[model samples]
Target chain A: MSLPLSELPTDTVAKVVTLEVGQDYRRRMAGLGLRPGVAIRVIRRSPLKGPLQVRVGHTDIILRRSDAVRIRVEPMPQTRGVPADAAHPEVVPAP
Target chain B: MKRIALLGMPNTGKSTFFNRLTGAGARVGNWPGLTVELLSARILLAGQMVEVVDLPGIYNLHGFSEDEQVVRRFLESQPLNLLVLVLNASQLDRQLALALQARHLGVPLLLLLNMEDEAQRLGIRIDSAALERALGVPVRLLSAKYGQHYREALAAIERSLKAHPALRRADRRALEEDQHIEQALDRLVQASVHAPVQLPPTLSERIDALLLHPWLGLPFLLLILFVLFQAVYALGSPLQDGMEVLLGEFRRSVLDPALAGLPSGLRSFLAEGLYDGVGTVLTFMPVIALFFVALAIIEDSGYLARIAFLVDAIMQRLGLDGRAFVMQLMGFGCNVPAVMGTRIMRSRGLRALTMLVIPFSLCSARLQVLLFITTAVFAPTTAPLVLLTFYVLSVLLAMFTAFIWRGRYVNREPLLMELPPYRLPTLRFLLHEGWRATLQFLRGAGGYIVLGVVVVWFLTHYPFDAPPASPATLAGRLANGLAPIFSPLGLDSLLAIALLFGLVAKEVVIGALAVIYSAGPDQLPGVLAQRLDAIQAMSFLLFILIYTPCVSTIAVIRKESGDWRLTLLAVAWPLTLAWLVSFAFYQTARALGY
Candidate 1:
């Protein structure tokens, strides 16, 4: 299922579908290796709605939650065994 | 002279490479814009003198950010002999995309794979020969920090310049397509790079788990700040005292006796005006140096970016980027560096807003005067409370100012900063950074400080032939003219004049007060108590806390912002705020029968 990147559970890998934002933001993110079709791992998220830490290739970047919400991502099919915590995702997708 | 420009993605160790190539100490922080302006140094390479320009880091030539525009404009205007593209070997996937984009810029290029040691540690290796063949440029793998493979890079640069390689501009439309760039990066990475399939959890990730934790991160940040303040005080105070004593003794024993042969007016001018004015600024060098050393270590270790990540939400609410919080922390040490430190902020609006709020950070100079007043005017038990209140007010005022200024324009920049892997800060790098910051501070702000002191000295000393010139001079006359304006805050002519002299530098206020009252430092408290009641004293302290920044700070603000209107606002806003706040405090205290 495709969702905003901010809704992706920590440790889940996903491919960027698109950045549903302004051209400038998309360009800036693209320069940082956040281009569409590129896979990224949601490594961590701050507890109080802070920035999300996403690993893109070998580089780790912090994105504000607001910006993260604008980035569309589709979950990658699990290649390794699915972790039990994946069953109970922490983030609820924005309605 | 032929020109070569260093270009790369942010945090790719471009400045470090620039420092190595030019043997210049260009500022290199983990964050961006340490080289905000174009910095060029003349170097003799292989018997040819070439000007090497360190351009601000840019993600792509077509990028819209200010730094990218700077790079774009320079590339368009300057006739370059060679373009050196620096890349982080550990993150070659993204960095190479920038390299590919720059190659299309039609500049003759030499690609440098910097930070090869980190790449090696990560079990990532790049075949530079393969990459060079693929990109059609000479490529060298180097660790600029360790000076690895620099000679080969320089030789290649010389060769590239001599050969005058053909320039081919990349298709602008092709460069604009995101998917096209990504596919090209994938192709380049697959052809030339090798890495372990499953990397271990890195040290940086492990540290970030704790440092960026929601519950623990804020407290950790506070603890770091607490420790930094303690370190600055505990380490800096003894050195400050020692320098103070040494300079005082030299003035009394050597300088005064040597200058006794001159006319008394000239002697006083040389001793008090020139020496003492500059000496006051010099005495704070140890503290300023200590602050920068600690800041450098924090920045180099990559924790500063984490702090920015941690505080982005809170700072955003105040209409500032998270980076402004770091600048505010630096302001507590001294606002001059804090103002210059705003160069790191990429947005002009953010820089201006951060600079505006920084003056309220209770810098060391203002703290000294507040410390003096609190200890003198209040009881022992209440002194600490008063001092704490002043600090709290400083922060509150800064936030309030930011609150008013936050929505002036809608800031569209997202917080998309790279979290660089942590590395231990080398002592040599730390000391060099500290020394360079201190020298920059002195070189930029020292002249204004000296001028201010000499001007004040002349104002107080003019009509020198008059005996017992004591506060009856032109400065005194001017102070008397302005006294009624401050009378509501319980300031007499002497207190008013001392504050006027404080425009030179805040630290001189206490000394100016001492001179005005014709009392020794030890007798200051008694004279102060005799002149004013506790309420009035409190009002005066409040005024000192919020008044206009010192002359040096204004000079730096002007230099950094390049805006006289903003500099005028910097002076006018604080002065107005100081008066309104002090007046309110004094009136409220009197109405409440304090």
Candidate 2:
């Protein structure tokens, strides 16, 4: 569903459908590899209602929750598979 | 020996790579030319020797900030044989911009994908070979955190050096925002990568709820700062006290006895001047080191960026971006680094603004004032309250100074900063940083402290060589001259003379006093304990805290601002404010019958 990023819940994991940042900020985000189709895991809900710590690839970024709402994503069942001692379930190591 | 420069965005494990490469430790250094300081290390990699200059991290090579200039200048000079472009794998796009800029420099570049493990953990996949093809450089994907990629990166560099022997420089125009190059990078990233990444649905809604709540965020920021200060003071005090006593005892037993056989003038000068002044100040090294260690740990763990986010708006009001707050916090430990940290402030005006307000951060030298007054003036119970007031006042002074600078030179741009994640700070890293700070303090005390003590002793002891009214007492005369200037502030004593001696090094004031006011152990109790009264003591504390930062800090300001006008402004403004504040407090205390 298309909702602002700020509406995300504490335990939710989501894929970034799109980033609705300004041109300057967009250029910066693009440079950081935060493309439209990147999956990000929310590590922390801001205590000050400021930003969410989303884990994308190997880095965790704090993006304003309002920014997150524009990106659309679908929910998947929380996998309980031995979690692979992995941080991101979707990532495959270099073969 | 081939020359190499390590370049990356802030928080990319470039430092870890340096440690892994050279086995040399990371410590702060004065970046050549600029007063701005950054981490640097000289390491011998492989059999053939090369110096790896760790360049300051920046988002873009095209910026006016001293940090950006530092990189640009190094690139322009063609000083290095090879440029090691370290990229945070987790944040590739932004890092690539810098790498692209490096490519434009046309220097032989080896791109190392640092933090690959963390990147994998975050569900991002990268094809190193693909990226290597795209950038026309060797790309080694390994975790600097675990030292996984060192061998591959090193081997690649060694191989490249053997084959090429000389590096090629890229044309500057090639890096100048060419759409063709940008499109090529995009195409390369898409073709070689096999990840259609998406944000998780649940986490999105959760963040939406918290960060968007206007009412909750600001208070949370305030609470975080409160807790941080409390932690700094609570955790640091006992360690600070222990060091103080140890240094005091060492002086009394070892240093003091060594000087006893000398004439009373020589004895007092050596015992009190060198040992007491610089010694007492250096003893607080433990606390200062603890503070810096805590700060570095927070920054490394990535939580410090959040602090920047939370306070960005307030900081912007001071003609500074929120980044300056981080620098100011650095100022709490030492203004030298804090002024240097101002390099992170993007705008020149904002950087200057940060530099100007930095001296207000109540550095370690001011800690002596805090300790002395809190103990001497108020009842032991009121010590905490006094300490709290001083901290609060320092912050208020910072805010007030920001307001003044904003009115004079306002930059109305809103702050946009990257907030890094909340990871637990690693113990190994924290201890390493802490040890460096502690050692610097010890070395500083050993070198500058001893020398400063000797100078003060010479100033106060030789020439006239008498007590109370000795002609050899330049320190006494200077104090007497400066004392009246402070009379309105209600602090005029030998302690005042010590404060003048303090201009050399704040700690020297203590040493000067130990010699200037020498009653035997029976007469003089807990150091300055017997000399100054509560009201005057508090005034003395207030004066030191606010007056001047120090000579090193001033020199750094002169270097960073480049204009002597700004440097003078940095010094004069703080001195005036300090005097006014101390006067007000002293009068208010006297009115209350303290």
Which candidate has the highest DockQ of all? Answer: 1
How much lDDT does candidate 1 score?
0.78
Give the whole-model CA lDDT for all candidates, comma-separated.
0.78, 0.63
Candidate 2 per-residue lDDT, tens place, B1-594, comes to: 577778888778787777667653555566555545556666555566666677777666665445666777656644566888888776664466666667767677888888887667656788887787777888888787676756787888787666556645545554444342344444655655444344233342355345434566556655655566557666776777677788878877888778777887666765666666566456556665666666676577655676656654455446665567777875776676567556445566777778888888877667764665466546789888878878888888888988888766555332334555445555666777667666655543345445544665566655544563232467666667776678888766566666666665565455455555664433433655555667777777777777776665665566556668887888788789878987888889889898
Candidate 1 C-alpha lDDT tens digits along B26-131: 4432223333456667888757777788888877767778787677666665667788999999988678888777777666888999999999998897998899
lDDT (C-alpha) at residue B415 in model 2: 38
What are the DockQ scores of the candidates, in order?
Answer: 0.41, 0.16
Candidate 1 residue B534 Cα shift, in angstroms, is 1.7
- Give the residue spans of candidate 1 off by over 4 A: A79-95, B25-36, B165-180, B261-264, B408-412, B465-471
How does model 2 score by TM-score? 0.73
lDDT score, candidate 2, position B7: 88
User: TM-score, chain B only, every model?
Assistant: 0.91, 0.78
